[model samples]
Structure formats: C-alpha cells, structure tokens
Target: MNGAESLVETLVDNGVDICFANPGTSEMHFLAALENPRMRSVLCLFEGVATGAADGWYRMKDKPASTLLHLGPGLANGLANIHNAKRASSGMVNIIGEHSTSHLKYDPPLTSDIEGLARPLSHWVRRADSSDTIAWDTVQAVEQASQHPGKIATLILPGDTSWREVSAQVELPKRVAAQPKVPKAPDAARIAHIARVLQSGEPTLIILANKATRGLALERAGKIAAATGARLGSQFFTARIERGAGRVPIERIPYAVGQATEFLKGFKHIITVETREPVAFFSYPDKPSLLKAEGTLVHTLVEADEDSALAFEILLDELGAAHAKPVLQQRVEVVVPQGALNPLSIAHALSAAIPENCIVVDESLTTGRESMGHTMGAKPHDLINNLGGSIGYATPVATGAALACPDRRVFCMVGDGSAMYTIQSLWTQARENLNVTTIIFANNSYAILKAEYANMGAGVPGARALSMIDIDRPSIDWQAMAKSMGVPSVSVDTAEAFHKAMADSVRTPGPVLIQVRL
Candidate 1:
C-alpha cells in the first residue's frame, strides 16, 4: 500500500473517522485514498471552514477530527481558526501536503516553510520522511491529538512519501492512555485565612473557569458561596462553560477594564478556582491590565489543567462546608416575548426560546456578551465559546456539534460580519440536514473592532476610518444567502418575530436561519 493508504488506515484504526478537507494538487493522492468507505470526507469551500469544523467536532465529541490541507498556503489560510482550536484544547490532526523531496530543492513558490507556520498553534508537529514511516507517524499524531484536554497535531506529508511504495509492511503504533491530572490541595493555612476573611464580613469574590464552570466544581463552589456568603464569578471569556437552566450560574466578569474594575471593587478578597485574578481582554492606554479591585487579596485554590472539581471538593471539605446545599436550582420555562427588537430584546426572546438539551455556539462577539447572563435560567444546555477569539467559528462549529449529538439542537449565534467569515458553512449544515438554528445579528459592521479601536487608545476616527469599520455600503440579505445555500431562513426586526422564527425553526427538523435586523 502507498503512504496515503497506510495513513488513512492508521487514522481510522485510532478512531478518527471524519476528515474536513480542502484539497489541491499536492493532496490528490490522499484524496483518492479517501474512497475507502471507512473514512468520511467533508469538502469545505475554505481552509478556515475545514479547520473550524474540526474544532466544533472535537468540542462536542471530545475526540479529534482530521483536516486535509493542500500545501503551505492552504495551511496558512487555515491557521487563524487552527489557533483558536488549539486555545480551546480541541484535538485535531492537520494532514498538510507538501511537494516531493526532489521538488523542494528547487525552492518553488509554494514551498514555503509549513512547519514554521504550524508550530505556534500545534502541540505536536512531525513531517513523514519516507513512505515506510507514514503509518507510524500518523499513529503518533492521532495519539497526541487524543490526549486529555485535547491537542493539535500536524503531520506534514511530502508528495513522494505519499505516492512511493514501501518495501516493508507498515505497522501502526499502540496508543498511549492520557495522563491523569493531580490537583494540588489548597493549603490548610490558606483555607483558614480565607475562612477568616469570609467570617470578617469583608466582601469577597470566588472566580471560576475550566472544570469549575460545570457539574461538581460548580456545585461545590455554590456550596462554599452559600456557606460563606462570597460572590461567585468567572473570567470574561472561558474555554468551555457548562451553564443554562437548572445549572448553578456564576456571574461573568465584564470584558471592559473599567466595567470589570467597577464590578470587582467591592471585593476585598478574590479567590480563584482553576484560573487567576481577572484581567481585561486588552489594554487601554492608561487603564490597568489586571482587573482586580485595588487592595483585593488574590488566592488560588486550583490551577488550570489541575482537577478543579476535585480541588473544590477538597476545599469544601476543609472548610467544614461539605453537604451544604447549592443555591436553589431553578428552570425557566420558555415564554415567547413581545416588543420591538434590539440587543436586549433579542436576548429576551432567546431566553424564552432556547430549547432543552441544546448546544449554543456563540460567535456573535459584540452583540452576544449579554447572552450568557440573560440565558442563564433558560433550559439546560451546553455553551461553547470562541476560545480562539477568531471570527467565523460559530456556524461551522454548530454544524459539527449537531453532527456529534444528533439528538440535541444546535443554536449558532453569529454577528453579521463574523457570519460572512465562513458563511459557506450553511451549505454543509443543509446537506447534512443538521439541527442548527443560525441566528445572524445583522448589525452590518465589525462592531467589536469599533469598540477595540477606542480601547486601544486610537482617537475617534474621521469619516474615512469610520467607513472602514462599517459594512453597510451594501448590506447583505441573509435570507437570500441562506436560501441560496439550501437552508430556509427568515428576517425579523422585532422580539416577537425573532421568538416566533426561533420556535418555528426548532419545532421543525432541518437547518434554519434567523436574521435579527439591528
């Protein structure tokens, strides 16, 4: 068998069955091998779509998916989203095709350094030197990606290596088990110190992230808060947060430095679980990067990658707070809202319409910050964030999430500008008949960048600069776009209309798009 065939067999053996691919000349051999029924190849219009879809698949399935990119430029085009996938701890094996060794010596234009571009975002990187080693190399890449918390593994395949015949039979390597996490116990003295602070009646806050955002860690944090009267909060943006109806909700620190500082001002002590003291997402000219209130004492109960849930459990036990009941759990029954639509009204409508056991993929950057708090009491659901802060992630991620959990509804909330980044994802959703309700916040501008410009100390711009921030010279008609992509759609300007549209979309089976006119 050729190297491409062996590589495919190895990935399938390691349980990576889905491949999101955007191929070119260099990848033809590997693409041909994809005829094997065991592997499912998804054609993506853009390299970014391929990478973003793989990311979404990992978020829902907790398993790595592969992406087949043509060459250096293809990998480069996909790098932004791959950076995001890496930050999210979403495992993925990127199979990057390269020119033959003989061709490389001539230094062709496409022969740019692929490894240099991939290293920053990848945890594991290797180039197959020969056809005989491809199988073993692929096995290692899969194992690395499948590691606990997930990782990015890039395997560069030279053209000659993929097409050449191996004299000896290739063998796949045995997969290694993920290493167990060992959480550090909070020191007794530190626990006693925090207890004294809580008893002292000084205002305090307990921040959470990672594993602390869900299940036992959240429950334990609630118990501690109930017993100690300390405020519960989380970082402004988390990797993966488990929240919504029936879950104990923690307040998120605001993204703006001034707002976060004001919010944190009352706390004299700030305790953390699986994260550090809160900080601004970006630095303003005169504003402090750290968002802690002046004089607030910061303490760490657990570090990220440590077993935060276990650490919280131990801390609760240490505080003699075990068995303390959580803050009362309540579920909000869906109630369709009325009135004209805006950000607030749209949030209200969403709170009333979100379905139970749903997965909400949020890339509606500027318009969706309030969504977390507003939808906190809605039906139980999983919330996935754009951990890599890249635009055009939500739609594709929603596609993969729907595929992974066919029983659950996937709600993709994206800003109009961000939606355009990977709008082609709509076609994939329609083709698969994925249960995705894509809500596009049609503000027609890069609204988040506008906010960032002021935050970055740039003086309010003249008409020319402002024009660059705006996208409305010719606004896109999302309904037409969705229809063209084979997904049904509706445009709404009022809360009632949006709610009805969301309800109708969810009640029916296939993909639907709701354009919320701003």
Candidate 2:
C-alpha cells in the first residue's frame, strides 16, 4: 500500500473518520487516498474554514478530527482559527503537505517552514521522514490530540512521503489501543483546603472553565454553591458550556473592563477551577488588569490537567454537601417583541424562538452580547464562544457542530463584519446539507471597535476614523451572497420577523441563512 493509503486506513481504524480538506498540488496523493469509503472527506474553500470546522467537530464529538492543509502558506491561512482552537482546547490532527525532499534543493516557490508556522498553535508537531513512518506519525498525532481537554497536533508530510510505496518487508503498523490521558485527580489536601474556604462563610466566587463548566462537574459545583453561599461564575468568553433551563446556570462576567470590575468587586474570595483568577480582557487607561477587588484571596481548586469532576466529588465529601439540592434554572416565558431590532429585543426574540437541543455558536460581539443572558431560561442547548477573541469563528464552528450532531440544529449568530471573514463556510454547509441556521446581524460596521474606541479614552471618532470601522459605503447583499453559495436565505428587519425566521428555519432541511438588517 502507498504511504497515503496507510495513513488514511490508520486514521479510520483509530477514531478519526472525518477530514476537513483544502488541498494543493503537493497534497494530491493524500487527497486521492481519501477515496477510501471509511474516511469521509469534506472540501473547504479556505484553510481557515477547515481548521475551524475541525475545532467545532472536536467540541461536539469530544474526539479529534483531521484537517488536510496545503503547504506553509496554507497552514498560515489556517493559523487564525488554529489559534482559536488552541485557546478553546479543541483537539485536531492537522496533516500539512510539504514539497518533496528533492524539490527543496531547488528552492521552489511553495517551499517554506511548515513546522515554524505550526508550533505556536500546535501542542505536538512532527514530519514524516519516510513512507514507512507516515502511519506511525499519524498515530502519534491522533494520540496527542486525544488528550484530556484536547490538543492540536500537526503532522507534516512531504510529497514523496505520500506517493512513495511502502516496502513489502516493512510490515504495516497495526492500530494500537491508545491510552487516553485522563485528567489527574486533584490533591486531597488541596480539596480539603478549598472545602474549608467554602465553609468560611465569606462571599466567594468559584470560576469555572474547561471541563468544569459542564455535565456532572457543573452539578457538583451547584451543590457546593447551595451548601455554601459561594456563587458560580465563568469568564466572559468560554469554550463550550452546557446551559439553559433545567441546567445549572453560571454567571458570565461582563465583557467590558469597567462592568467586569464592578461585577467582581463584591467577591471576598475567588476560587478557580481549570482556569485562572479573573482578569480584564484587555488593559485600558487607569484600569486594573485583575478584576478582583483589593485584598481578595485567590485559590486554585482544580488545575487545568486535573479532574474537576473528581475534585468536586471529593469536595462534596469533605463538605458533606453531596445531598444538597443544587439550584437549577427554571424555564421562563419570553415575549417576542414586534417592532425595532435592538439588542434587547433581538435577545428576547432569540429566547422565544430557540429550539430544544440546539447548538448556539455566538460571535455577535456587539449586537448579541445580551443573547446569552436572555437565553439562559430557554430550551436546553450547548453554547460555544470565541475564547481566542477571533472573529468569523461562529459560522464554521456551527457547520462542524451540525455535522457532529446531525440530529440537532445549530444556530450561528455572527455580525456582518465577522461573517465576511469566513463567508466561504456557507458553501461548505450547503454542500454538506448541514442543519445550520446562520443569523447575520447586518449592522454595517465593526460596532465593537466603535465601542472600544470610546473605552480606550479616545474622543468621539472623526469622519475618517468612523470610515475605517464602517462598511456602509456599499452595503453587502447578504441574500445574494447566500444564493451564490446555494443556501436558501431570508432577510428580516423587525424582531417579529427574526423570531419567525428562527423558528421556521429549523423545520426545513439543510442550511439556511437569516440576514437581520439592524
């Protein structure tokens, strides 16, 4: 078998069956190997979309998905989403194509440092030296990606390495049962210390992240909060959280520096879980970087690589709070607004229209910031946020999540400016016939930047400064753009229309776009 065939077979034999690919000439052999029925190949127009899709897949599937990128330039094109995925702790195995070894001596145009491009975002990076080693290298990459909380692993394959036939004498490597690197148990002393702190009667806030924000870990945290007076909080931007009616809700720290500082000032102690002490998203003039009040003590209950559920289980034992009734968010009825599509009205409409078991990918930095708070009591759903502060992540991530959970609908909320960054994601969604409802908030500007300008103590923006942030010079025809990509779409101006669109989109099959003109 050719090296590329072995690599594909190995990936399928292991658990990675889906591949997001944007290939070039150097990757043709590997692309051809994708014809293996066991491996499902998805074509992405941009490398960023491929990487972002892999991130989404890992988030929903709780497993690594493979991505095939072209040369160094291709990897670079994908780096932004890779940065987002790394920050989100989503597992992915990236196979980057490289020029053949012989061609490198001639200094070919496409030749560049693939390893250099991958290191900052990747937890593990390797290059296949020969055809016989490709399968082994792929196995190692998958193992790295499968670690607890997930990791990015990049495997570089030279052109010859993929096309060259493996020698018959070299027996093909069999799939080994990879040992999943589970999260280590927290120290008993540390758990006991935290238990004492919780019982101190001081107003404390337990900040959750990573694996601590969902499932049994979250329920245990709620019990701890119920037994003690501690409040549960989360960062402004978290990777993935399971929330909604019937789930334990977490208070999201405000996004703005001033607001966040104000919200956090009341806590006497801050306990961290798989995350750090609260800090401002960015530094501003005369503002403190840490959000906590003066003299507040910070304690670590669970390290990033530690088992949060286990820690909480032991903490429950120490506090005798295992039987404490945990507080759960009750379902609330939201009235859908009629006229005007402001943030509050939009949020209400969303809360009223969200379907059960939907996956919401949020990148509506400005308009939909309130959506989360409003939807807290809506139908049960999973929420994903941009932890890396990157734009254009919502649509592609929604695409991946929909593929991962084909039975569940995905609602992607992104601003017009951010949507343009990876609008190519629409085509892939359409091609895959994914169950994705993409909502584009067409505000005609980088509205968040406009807010940041004032937050930075810059006076009112001048005409020139406003021009830089505004995209109103020629308004984008979002409907036409959606049509070009073969996805059915609708335009909404009123809250009622938006609410109706959201409710109706899920009923129809395949991908649909809703352009909310604000």
Clash tally, candidates in order: 0, 0
Off by over 4 Å in 2: none
Model 2 TM-score, all chains together: 0.99
Error of 1 at 385 (Å): 1.7
Task: Give per-residue CA lDDT, model 2, range 249-316, as digits (tens).
Answer: 99999998888888988888999999999888888998889889998999999998799999999999
CA lDDT, candidate 1, residue 1: 80
What is the Å distance of residue 314 in model 1 from its true position?
A: 2.2
Give lDDT tens digits, candidate 1, residues 1-518: 88898788778877888999999998888998898798988888889988998988988787889999988899998998898888777889999999999999999889988999899889999999988888888878887887656789999999999998765655545433223324455465656666666667778898887667777878888888888888889877676677776677788888788888999998889988767788776667999988887788997766555666766676677678898887844776646667877667778888888888888888877888777778888888888887668778888788878877888888999999989989999998888888999999999899998888888878786799889989998999999999999999999988899998988888999899999998
Candidate 2 lDDT for residue 343: 94
lDDT of each: 0.83, 0.92
> What is candidate 1's CA lDDT for residue 236?
72
For this target, which candidate reaches the highest lDDT against the unseen true structure?
2
Cα displacement (Å) at residue 129, model 2: 0.4
